[model samples]
Target: MDRMSAQKRRESVIRAAIAEFARTGYHGTSTAAIAKRVGVTQPYLFRLFPDKKAIFVAALMRSMDDTRLAFERADDGMEGGGQALRAMTGAYAHLMSTCPETLLMQMQGYAAVAAAEAQGDDLIGEVVRAGWMRIWETVHLSLGADADETASFFACGMLGNTLTAIGLPASAGR
Candidate 1:
């Protein structure tokens, strides 16, 4: 395949994989399913990612990075946590309108993590914690809080609020 076509194919697969993995979990998502979704075969999917796990990991990493970047960009225009969160929420609401699949994938990942926890697996938990700490640290710095206790104090609280907001969006008025 040509370079652009290959790149497009990869993106299509990733998008489809995100939805599939989100719906099916990492273990349940099959290469054939993703390939079929991307209008290819199982072997072609393998050409992009050696295995399903690798693709799921890549998608999760991309999601985390994208969230961080979005937060930073939205935060840049505001001076306080409340204002920043408003902008961030607006961005999220906009995203919710535009790219709902990304959000759905994230929600699916959380569900998969919960399922993993039930099965005595902690991979998603560790990954989620690390992703959270990064966000909390950023929020702490934004708040001009003491760095020494930031992770445990502000970061922890912020992380809790975030999960809560995501989990209880309707109840939280988010």
Candidate 2:
């Protein structure tokens, strides 16, 4: 196979890493496992990511990026928070139904957020906050939520139901 560009290599590793993590859980996945899946060597994996934790973080960031895009696309032509949230939740729920194991990715990301909250590490929680902030802006003050309250509602509501949506009826996604 032709060598991949740095961006492609990075993305390839992240995808493989997610697959590994999803199947094996964060602690069970090994760098060798990720490298083998990516068709690269352990050293190559390390070159892309310093360690397994780094790989997990990279994969988590990609998942968050996808989640953000879901909200962005959901907001298109949607009138208010309820509508935008329905669209977003539908997209997320569809993902859960089709790929239930991606729930592992969701869990790891949530763990990152929980840890960050305890230690004041804002990076992970910021991902959840940013998506909710957009929802807040789209809904406007009519929802009676200031930014903090809106973010809390989102963190507690939609984000909390992602995994639970698995095995929901097909109508849930639609």
Best by lDDT: 1
For residues 1-174, write the lDDT of model 2, one tens digit per residue.
996797899899998877777666666788888888889988877887777767887787676565556555765776655665567667656665665544556566665677767877676677646644554564334233456645654564454454253434544523
RMSD of 2: 4.9
User: Lowest lDDT 10-mer window, candidate 2?
Assistant: 165-174
TM-scores of all models? Answer: 0.68, 0.66
Off by over 4 Å in 1: 1-8, 114-122, 143-174
Please report, in order, the local distance difference test score of every candidate based on alpha carbons: 0.65, 0.64
- For candidate 2, give the lDDT of residue 116: 63
lDDT of 2 at 107: 65
Index of the highest-TM-score prediction:
1
